[model samples]
Target: MSILATEIWENRFFNGQWAVAEKNYAVTEVATGDQLGVMGYAQPSDVEYSAQQAKVAQEKWWALSYQERAQIFENAIQVAIDHKADIIEWLIKESGSIVMKASFETDLAIQALKNAMILPSSVQGSVLPTQNGKLSLAKRLPLGVVGVISPFNFPLYLAIRAVAPALALGNAVVLKPDERTAVCSGFVIARIFELAGLPKGLLHVLPGGAEVGEALVNDPNIASIQFTGSTEVGRIIGAGAGRTLKKVSLELGGKNSLLILDDADIELASQNIAWGVFLHSGQICMTSGKILIHQSIFEKVKQRVVEKVQQLKMGNPMDPSVNIGPLINQRQCQRVEGLVQSAITAGAKLEVGGKANGVFFEPTVLSQVTQDNPIFEQEIFGPVAVLMPFATDEEAIALANMGDYGLSAGIITSNVSHGMQVAQSLKVGLLHINDQTVNDEILNPFGGFGASGNGTRIGGPANVDEFTQWQWMTIQAQAPNYPF
Candidate 1:
C-alpha cells in the first residue's frame, strides 16, 4: 500500500506495528487547503505506550553490531532514493514547497541519511591515564529512547537530522511531527525505515497536536528530547523537560542577518540577499531576517534585491515555474501580514512587494527600517526583506547583533580577512562568508545560540554528544586494592 494514499491513516506506525487510532486528524495541502488525508491522533496514553515500547526495543537494537546497524541506514538511503519522486510530490503538496525548494529539501534528506550510515562507527571512546594496577576508560552509550518533536517548516530535513543520527547511534525514537506535515515529516520516514528492514518497535510515529507533544516531553520513559520549532515553544519544552532531568536539544527560531559590505561584489551580494530572504518564502529558521548594507551601496543593493524579488512568481507549488509558494497556512500568512504592515506603519518604506492574496503573500522588501520597527529584530518568517544601512564595519556588526536571536548570519565581502573578523563579532552560531545564511551541510554543526537554541549542536560529531551519555569505567586484572 502506498503511504501517501488516504488509507494510510488506518495503518499509521505506532509502538511495534501499524495500528489504527481511535481518533484522527485531517491533513491538508498548504497551497490549496484541500484535504490530503487523515492521520492517527495520539492521546497522552498513546504517547506513553509508544515510549514504553521504544524503551524495550532500544536494548535489542543496541545489541546489533555496528556493521549490522549501518547496513540498515544504507538500505534506507536506497529506499529513499527509489522514492524520490513521491517524496518530492508530497513535499510540494503537503508542505507548500516549490519545485526548487522541494528538490533541495529532498536531496538534503537523502544526504542526512547517508551521513547517518557512518555514525555507528564514527563514535569513539577515550582511555584515561591511570595509576599502576588500574586501567580506566570512558565510553559513550545511547540515551535509551529519544523523543523527537519537529515543526512544519523544512519538515523532512529537520526531522531526519535528529531521527537518523539517534537511531544509528543505538537509541530508539518516538517521533511527534507537527500535525500539519504528518505525511512528509512522519509517515514518509516511517515507511522508509519499515521498507529498509529496521526492526519493529525501534521507531514510532505519532502525529497530533500540543497535548501529544506535552505528553512526549513529560513521559518518563523518554530519556532525551530533540525538538525543532519556534523559540516560544522551545522555552516551554525546555522547561518541561528540565523538570524530569531529561536531556533536551532545541533547534529554535532565528532572526538572522545578511551583511553586505562596501567591497562586496554587488551582483553576488544581491543574489545572496535574494536567496537568503526569499528562499522557501523565507520560512527557514536560518532565513535572513535583516539585510544590512554599507551606506555607500545600500540603494544599489536594495534596488537589485527588489528586482529579484519582483521577478519571483508565487502560486501553487506543483507548478515548476513558481519560485515562491504559499505560506504554510492562513494563521502563518496572517502573522506575516501583520509583521509587514506593522513595519510599514512604523516608517519603513515598502520597496517592491507588500500584498497578500490569501496565503500567497507577495515577496516584500522594506528599507529605511529603524531599530524601533517591529520587523527589524523579529523573525519575519516570510518572504519579506528588511534593509538597514550602516556606515562602518563596527556599526554593521552592531546592527546585526541587535537581536535576541543568534542563530545564523552571513557576510559578503571581497576582503575575506575583514569578513572573518566581522563574522566573529556576531553572536550567531552559524556563519557564512560570501554566501547566504540559508546553508547547511551534514558535516557542519547545524544549530544556533541563545534564543535560537539551548546550545545544542546537531550534525557530524555533535550527534555523538546529543544522542549519547558518557560513562567512566575502571578495570584491574583482579580485585582492586584499597587502603582499608
Candidate 2:
C-alpha cells in the first residue's frame, strides 16, 4: 500500500474459505524498508469476502453479553501466552526487534487481553440520583465495528491493545497491521481469537499496509479508528476519519524526558536510563527522549550512563545476550544518524554515537543539547538520547517541558513532594518518580496528552470505557413527581 511495504504470510484462514490474500504489502525489505518483497494486493474477492464477514459477524458479535465478550478476550490472552516462544521468533525476523523487546511487548499484549476479559463492570455507568418517578440510566454500549490501525513498533502490543478492547465491548474489528510485523503478530493474534472461540470475523486481521488500511478506515462498516504511530501520518488518518465522524483514538509520537536530581541514586538512575533509552533502539513513543540532570550529579550521572551504554551488546536480535538491535531499517538508521549529526553541527556534543555503519547504529547519546535542537523538539524513533544539565528544579521542569510532545517523563528522586510537584507540573500523560518513564502495569490506564496523541490502550476497568460509548436511557413513569 505504501510503496514496497509488503509482507508474505501464509493464508490459514482462507485455506478452505472462498477468498485468499495474494500479497501482504507493496513488497519491500523486511527490516530496512528497502524495496524487496513482491508488490501484490489481496484479491478483490478476498477483500470483499473479509468485509462481508465483518458485516455479518457484527450482528452476532454485538449481540453477546459483556461477560461472554470478555471471555473470548481472556481465552485469547491464554493462547497468546501459550505461543510466546513462537511469536518471539516471528517478532525478531519480521519486526527487527531484540528478543527482550519481543518478550516485553508480548507480555504487554497478553496483559491487555487479560484485562479486556473482565470489563462487564466497566460497562456499568451509575445513575444520577433524582427525585420522583422519572428514571435515568447511563450505560456503555459497543460500537458496531472498530477499525484498528497499528504501527510497526510494538506491533503485537499495539494491535492487541486496540483489538482486545473492541472485542471485549462486543464489537467486531477490522485490523490493519503494519506490513513488516504482520506475520508474527497478526497471525498469532488472529489464531488466539479463533482459539478463544470468538465469533469469526469479530476479530478479523487484514495483513496489509496503507492501502488495505485506507479501505477499512474509509469503509462505512467501520464505526471507529484506533491508531498508533508517527504524528505526521497519524494526523492524516485522524483527520480523514474525522470527516466521517468516526470515533478515533490515536497514540502518536513523543519526546519524553527523564530528570536526575542532585540527591538521586546514580547507579539506579544509570541502569534505568540504559533500559529506557537503548532498548528497542529507542523506537518507543514513551521512551525517554531527554536526560536532564542536576548540576551536582551531572558529571557523575554522565560517566555512569556512558559506561553502562558502552557495555550494551549490539548484535542480531535473535541472540539472547544482545541488548540492542538494528533500527527497523536502514532508512531509520539514517534518520537517527542525521539527527545526531545535526545536533553536533548545532554545537551539541555527540558523546557516544554520531555515525552509522549499516542498519545498526550504536546506542547513542548527545550531550550539551539545547532546546532549539530538532533532536529535542522532534521524536527520534531510534536509539538516540540527548543529555543536558539543570541548575535548579525550576530549570529542570522548564527543560523537561520544552518539547511539543508530552507523552511520558521520569524523575529519579525519592522525595514524595518533589515527585508530586514534577508530576503535576509536567504536561505529560504518565509520570514516574524514581523509575523509567516507560513503566506500565496491566492494571494501569495508558494514554497521552498533547501531541503524543489522544485516548489510551491498556487493560483495566477504565480501558473498557474506550471500547464502548456512554448512552443515557430515560424512562417516564406513569406518575412523575420530578419535572420531566
List TM-score per model, in order.
Answer: 0.98, 0.89
Weakest 10 consecutive residues, lDDT, candidate 2? 1-10
lDDT of 1 by residue, 1-484 (tens): 4545666555354556778888888878888989877778888988999999899999999999999999999999999998999999999999999999889899999999999999898846898999888889999899999999998889999898899999999999999998888889888899889889999999999988899999998999999999999999999999999999999999999999999999999889999998888888999999988899999999899888888987888899999999899998888888888888999899999888888788888999999999888888888889999899999999988888887899999999999998998988999999999898998888898899889999999998799999999999999899956999
Pairs in steric clash, model 1? none
Top-lDDT structure, candidate number = 1
Off by over 4 Å in 1: 1-3, 10-13
Report residue 200 deviation for candidate 2 (angstroms): 1.7
Q: Write the per-residue lDDT of candidate 2 for residues 405-453, one digit (tens) a residue.
A: 7789998886867777777788888888888877767676777777788
Q: What lDDT score belongs to each candidate, Candidate 1 first?
A: 0.90, 0.74
